[model samples]
Target chain A: MNYSNLFRIAIRALIRNKLRAFLTMLGIIIGVASVIAMLAIGEGSKQKMRGQISSMGTNMVMVMPNFQRRGGVSLGASSSMALKYTDVIALRNEAVDVGAVSPEIRASGQIIYSNKNTQTTIYGVSEEYLSIRKLEVLSGRVFNANETRSMAKVCILGQTVVENLFGKGADPVGLSIRIKNLPFLVIGVLKDKGESGMGQDQDDLILAPYTTVQRRLAAIDYINGIYASALSEEKSPAAIVEVEEILRRTHKLKESTENDFRVMSQSELLKTITSITDIMTYLLGAIAGISLLVGGIGIMNIMFVSVTERTREIGLRMSIGGRGKDIMKQFLAESIILSILGGVMGVVFGYLLARLAGSLMSSQAIVKTQSVVLAFIVCFVIGVFFGWYPARKAANLNPIDALRYE
Target chain B: MNTIIEIRNLRKDYHVGEVTVHALRGIDLKITEGEFVAIMGASGSGKSTMLNILGCLDKPTAGDYLLDGINVSSMEKDAIARLRNQKLGFVFQAYNLLARTTALENVELPLFYNPKVRARDRREAAIRALEAVGLTDRMHHMPNQLSGGQQQRVAIARSLVNDPVLILADEPTGNLDTRTSFEIMELFQNLNEKGRTIVYVTHEPDIAKFATRNVMFRDGKIYRESIVTERLNAKEILETLPVEVIEEFD
Candidate 1:
């Protein structure tokens, strides 16, 4: 018989027991739906991370003191204080790929403004720091080269710091705030930068000239870190290499000695984060695939039961000229129809579920076309793989024995 | 009359575990078109086995069997299946109509396996077969909705739908009441009179009397063979029986 006729017969048979058919399809539906939703959520979170990192400036690079071993005792990067203003000047002047460079020295202390006080970190940087870290001055100007050279007591307050010290939406430009009991003039209020991918608030700090923080507040000579930006995103790796070489040369490290500073680019961080999320996505997809395997088994179980139930009908068909292959094809068609229908429904259900979960989680859940296509191909293979044994059993049944079966 | 079935030394053996039981030891039979023959025997006397072999449902242990001039004894499973579809029809005692299917579809089933018949032609042939069995009015009813006699008639229509060279009926009336059995037999007789060949299998002597020829089996061998001198007409028998009153509940 033709395929159309076979499908018609298979459909009619399934319709005879609607509840059973639907129940069998339920397994496949749940399997495919979970796979789609899980993959979408994983992809969404990864994309969100990349977007946050890109906002931090795709070409941005950081040079921090490496963990130093002094007399077999390890001191972390924070306490090393190995970076210096000279290293920043060297990178700015010598590294062609480096677009901008800034030396950073931070001090955490209480700031008192008009009898209101809050604890926050004060980052000492130059005008280039704002551009490198994608910070913007909302009201006034940033600390320029003369201010950095003269150790001028001027600061730029982040939005959160501004709100905390000067009240919500308050313009604190030209205001004087006391930090570590020393008076500092606020030249500008930085625009809102929200939060980072690490869930840290980005707009909760104060910016000042590196010379002012080193001399006035902490009384330190060495800087904590150095931040720079590449001329373009594509030049970030080259910029990082240039910065590393300049720092190693300025530190006067021997040929066999490891550099005292570590250099990293924003794209590297993005890659690390996305790779982790990729693993999570596949792990989730594999877990969901177990359910699909179970669904395939469900199809096999139902097909076997159906074949047994219709033994006499098979015999009758055989007597009327149905070949073994015809009987096998009929049963296989029934299972394939069940699985493929479930797969289609699952794709729709998964897309909706992903959207719902995405909105609930306040993130975008992406449903890739490849995932849907893969689900369909998997469902088809599942249909055939699971439907084979039972169909063969039906085909191999002796016509006489089957007819005589009660 | 064309010879529709010819068998020589047909033997069928059944192996129950390591023990072998000879179901049909050695048998020779010939049936031609337009002849109504009944092969009758007691239970376990090999009548069923003989019918199975003749219908090509079972391959004999050693024998040559031909149906409509084609050697079917050594044919492969698929070839035999095609031959059965092309040249044979079957009516079982249980009616064997697919449950939940309309009588018309059940009748159309045999034609479904015939590649030569299109969907439209299949339906038309099924309708004609139902008309021949005088079940045209009940064609749309499911098998469960039809009475035993009507259900049997639908089965007869299914068997005739393919227009095969031979129709095999295994205890066609075994499940029916006497009146219904006679009605089905009358339908068979009517079809036979229209030049359709039939092979009927039953242990009932009265049922066997409806056929033109009777072959009896004892153990696994044919014990007796004879042409019916006084053939019993099912229509006359059915006419003499009391009418069944089907009560209608309002």
Candidate 2:
């Protein structure tokens, strides 16, 4: 028989039992949809993370302290033996590609006055710190460069801090708040930056000049860490190299001595997160793919049952000048048509589900076109591979015996 | 060599559990061209088995069977199918026409296997075959839409489509009344007059009267042979049968 006739016969036979055929296709539909949706969600999260990090300025880099060994003892970053505040001055003056440098001194405390006390984070840095960290003041005013030089007691509060310290009724500008019993006047209230993509509160801190923190509280001229902005995103790696060299030279370190700080660009952080998300996507896709395999086995089982159910019809066809290969071709065509139809429908349904999920959250629809193509290819292969044995069994039936069957 | 069918010492065995039932026991027979013959027997007397072997639908366990000068006993299964398609036609008792296919398509089925016949030619030939069996008006109707006699007529049309060397029919009129049975027999006679070889298997002696030759089987063997000493028409044969038998059959 020609391929068209085989296809026609197979399709007609399948359509004869509409409910069973539909039930059989349901397995394939579920399998394909699961695989598509899972891959899309995982890929969507990765994309969102990359977008958030990149928006924070690719030129931004972080410098954290590392352990230093005096004899043979090793320690961690919090050991107070690594980075220093003087390193920022050295990087700012000597590093060619550095644009701004600021030191961060952090301490958690409560500000209290007249029965109003609120817990908050206090950060210490220079006035250029606002520009370096991409923070903008919404009210009052930021401290000037001279204010930072003179170890002034001026401070800037973020939106959350202003809300907590002064409430909506009270004015925050020029108000005094006791910090560890040392009063400082609030010079500015920062803009409502809201939450970052990682769910960290961006407007929840109080910023004081670094000189005041060093002298009044810690009583040392050292810093916790440094934040530096590159001249441009394209020059970040060069700026990191320039800053590292300047610090090493000012510290008078030998060639054999290891640096006591870790310098990392924003892009490197983005890469680290992308690798993690990539692994997660693959793992979820694999788990969903197993259902596709199970769906294939279900098809095979039903096809075998179909062969047995129609043995007499098969014999009749064989007797009426049909070849064994014709029988084989008919059954194989039937299963392939079933799976391909299911795969096509599953792609549409999967996209609908993904779009619904994205819209419910007011987010972008995560449609990955490759997943549609990939799901179809895998399902088609499954049809052929799972359908072969049953088709062969039908083809190999004994014509005489089958004709004799009732 | 003029014989269209020749069987020598044909044997067929059926093993059901430990019991061995010999379905065909060393039967020897030869049917020449252009002869109408009948084999009559009681149930389980192997007349059906002989018809199956003659139609090439089954293989005999020990046999030397020749069909149109080819040794069918040694042919492979697929080659036997091809031989049946090319040289033999069968009309079954149950009128086993494909239920969902139209009469014209049913007649054209064997011709579909014969690719030498183009699609248009096959259609025309199927129409002509149906006309020859007096079913020209029912050509487009499915089997269930046709009566028992009309369905049998469609089957006869199918048997004639390929123009085989011989036709083997098993109980062709088994499901029909006396009037319809005679109508079919008349069609068979007319085809035989056109020089087609025909064999019909039956158990009713009166039905066997239509053929010029009769072979009766008993206990897996041909136990009697008889030629019609005097020709009898179907009406006359029905007229001679006892009224009790007719009433019981009705």
lDDT of each model, Cα atoms only? Answer: 0.90, 0.81
| lDDT string, candidate 2, B75-187, tens digits | 88778777777787778787767656789878887775664676668789989999999988888887878888889999898888888899888899999987778878888
lDDT of 1 by residue, A167-208 (tens): 899998988999989999999999998889888999999999
Instruction: Please name the candidate that would achieve the greatest TM-score relative to the true structure.
Output: 1
lDDT of 2: 0.81
The TM-score of predicted model 1 comes to 0.95
| Fraction of the native A-B contacts that model 2 recovers | 0.24
Instruction: Give the DockQ-based CAPRI class for model 1.
Output: high
Q: Estimate the TM-score of every prediction.
A: 0.95, 0.79
Worst 10 residues of 2 chain B by lDDT: B241-250
The i-RMS of every model, in angstroms, reads: 0.7, 2.5
> What would the TM-score be for candidate 2 when compared with the true structure?
0.79
- Give the winner by lDDT: 1
Tens digits of lDDT, candidate 2, A1-406: 5555557567767876788888888888888877887787778777877777776767887787766666787666344545677788788788788888899887778876556888887888887788877889887898887877787878888877777767853558877888878888888888877666677888888888888877775676568888989999889989888878887787788999887777888877888989998999899889989988888888999999988988876776666666677778888998998888888877777777767766675555476888888998998899999899999999898776766667
Error of 1 at A204 (Å): 1.8
| Span of 10 residues, lowest total lDDT, candidate 2 chain A | A74-83
